[model samples]
Target: MKNIFDKKITNEIIKRIDTLTPETQANWGKMSVSQMFAHCCVTYEMIYTEKHPKPNGFVKMMLKLFVKNKVVSESSYPKNGRTAPQFIISDEREFGTEKKRLVDYIIKTQELGEQYFDGKESHSFGKLSSTEWNNSFYKHLDHHLTQFGV
Candidate 1:
């Protein structure tokens, strides 16, 4: 997995994001380009803000057990795989707005660096090592950006 904390990798990811446009269509999945941007932002939102509710204890445990491995692993996601409810974006979104937010969040995560996330508590998964955090963050963005053919 690529290191999200590395400045070069972060800039490369931003370049991929910059290639997207309002009219970009997914190679699979139901999301519009803007909705995909919002969906990608959900991960960062969970990390940096209190906008989304943390899962209850039982739910968190289930996620950690059943979902954590897949999310934090180095494997690529299957096309149009099931997503968490929090990540579903059914409504319309402003393309430029969501794109900017996603870019900003990526920059913030990179700036914070690996040490800051060494044992960070995730929204759904429990505390994770920096490698796990980097894998989760980079993989998701890579998956979606690739989905839109960027």
Candidate 2:
């Protein structure tokens, strides 16, 4: 897995995102480019905003037990993998707005850098080491970017 905290890798990922446009079509999956961009934003939103509700104790336990490893691992996601409820963006979104928001979030994360995320408590998955944070962030973006063939 590429380290998102690396400046070069971050720029590469941003370049890939730049390749997407309002008319971009997924090679698979139902999300329009706008919806996909919004979906991707959910990850950053979990970190930088309080929009989503935190999981309760039992739900958090379940996520830690069954989902944390898959999310933070170095492995790539399987196609059509099950997403959490918060990550499902069913409505149409304004493509340019969502794209700009996603890019802004990426730039913000890069600016904050790894120190801000090292040993950070994730919204659902508890405290994550810096490597876990990097893997989770980079892999999801990479997967979705590849989904749109960007």
Candidate 3:
């Protein structure tokens, strides 16, 4: 997995995001460009904001047992795979706003650097290594960006 904390890789990802426009169409899947952008932002929001409610004890346990490995491992998500409920963006969103918010979150994550995430407790999973954190962030962004053919 590419390290999102690396300046060069972060810049490359941001450039890919810049390629997206309101009129961009998905290569597959149902999301419009704006909804896709908002969906992508949910990951960062889980880390940096309290916008989504945390899963309860049983749900958290299930996530760690059944979902953590696939999510944090250095593996690409299968196309059209299931997404968590918090990540489902059903309604239309402002393309420009969602795009800008995503870019800002990427910038914030990069600026914070890997040290900030080293051994950090994830919202769903327990403590994660920096490598796991990198994989989770980079892989998700890459998947969605590729979805839009950026």
Candidate 4:
């Protein structure tokens, strides 16, 4: 998996994000480009803000048991995978606002670097290693950006 803390990879990812606009349509999923951007931002929002509640112990246990591997592994996500309730963006979002939020999150994450996240607690999976964090961040962004043919 690519290191999300690396500047070069983050720049490339940002470049991919720059390719999107309000009119961009998904090649597969139902979300508009702006909704997709908002959806992508939800992960970072969970990480850096208190917007979403942390999963309860039972849900955390279930996530670690069943969802952690797929999320934090190097493997790519399957197309049309089910989204968590917190990640479903139903209302329309301004494209510029969502994109800027996402880019800022990426920059903040990269600035913090891998060591800063080495043993950080995740909302659903408890503490994760830096590499696991990188996989989850990079892979999810890649999946959604690619979904829009960016």
Candidate 5:
């Protein structure tokens, strides 16, 4: 997996993001480009903001057990995989707004870098090593960006 903390990789990712436009259509899946941007933002929001609720004990355990490895591993996600309820964006979104927000979030994460995330406690999955954090962050962005053919 590419390192999110690496400025070069992050810049490349941003370059891909810049290639998107309001009219960009997904090569696969159901999301519009703006919805995909918002969906990607959800991961960063879970990390940097308190807006989303943390899961309950049982839910957290389930996420940790069944979903953690898939999320944090350096593996590509299967196309059209199921997503968490919180990640669903059914309403319309402003393309410019979501695009800027996603870019800002990416820049913020890159500035914070890996050491800050090493052994950091995630909202649902407890503490993660830097590699796990990088895998989770980079893989998701890569998956969606590729999905949109960026």
Candidate 6:
């Protein structure tokens, strides 16, 4: 897996994002380009903002037990795979606004670097290593960016 904390890789991801436009069509899935951007932002939102409510004790335990590996591992997500409820962006979004937010989040994460995130408490999965954080961030963005054929 590529290290998202690396400047070069981060720039590459940003470049891929720059290619997206409002009318960009998904290669698969039901999300519009704008919705995809907003959906992608949910990951960072969970980390950097208190926008989404944290899962309760049982749900958190379930997520850590059953979902953590699938998320933090290097494996690419299956196309149109199930999205967590917090990540579902059913309503429309402004393409530029969402895209900028995603890009800003990526830049901020990269800027903070791995050390800042080492042993950080994740919103759902409790504490994780820097590697787990990188994998989760990069993999999700890559999946959705690829979905839009970027």
TM-score per candidate, chains pooled: 0.98, 0.97, 0.97, 0.98, 0.98, 0.98
lDDT of each: 0.94, 0.92, 0.93, 0.93, 0.94, 0.94
What is the C-alpha RMSD, rounded to one decimal, of candidate 5?
0.6
Q: Residue-wise lDDT of candidate 5 within 26-109, one digit each (tens)? A: 989999999999999999999999989999999999999999999999879999999999999999899999999999999999
Candidate 3 vs candidate 4: the TM-score winner is 4
The residue pairs that clash in candidate 3, if any, are none
lDDT of 6 by residue, 1-150 (tens): 999999999999999999988988999999999999899899999998999999999999999999999999999999979989989999999988998898999999999999999999999999999999999999999999999888
Q: Lowest summed lDDT over 10 consecutive residues: which window, candidate 2?
A: 105-114
For candidate 1, list the clashing residue pairs, or say none. Answer: none
- In angstroms, how far off is 54's CA in candidate 3? 0.7
Error of 2 at 74 (Å): 0.6
Q: Relative to the unseen true structure, what is the Cα RMSD of model 6?
A: 0.7
Error of 6 at 94 (Å): 0.6
- Per-residue error for 112 in candidate 4, Å, reads 0.4
Provide the lowest-lDDT 10-residue window in model 3.
17-26
TM-score of 4: 0.98
lDDT of 1 at 130: 97
32-142 per-residue lDDT for model 3 (tens digits): 989998999999999989999989999999999999999999888999999998999999999899989998999899999899999999999989988999999999999
Off by over 4 Å in 2: none
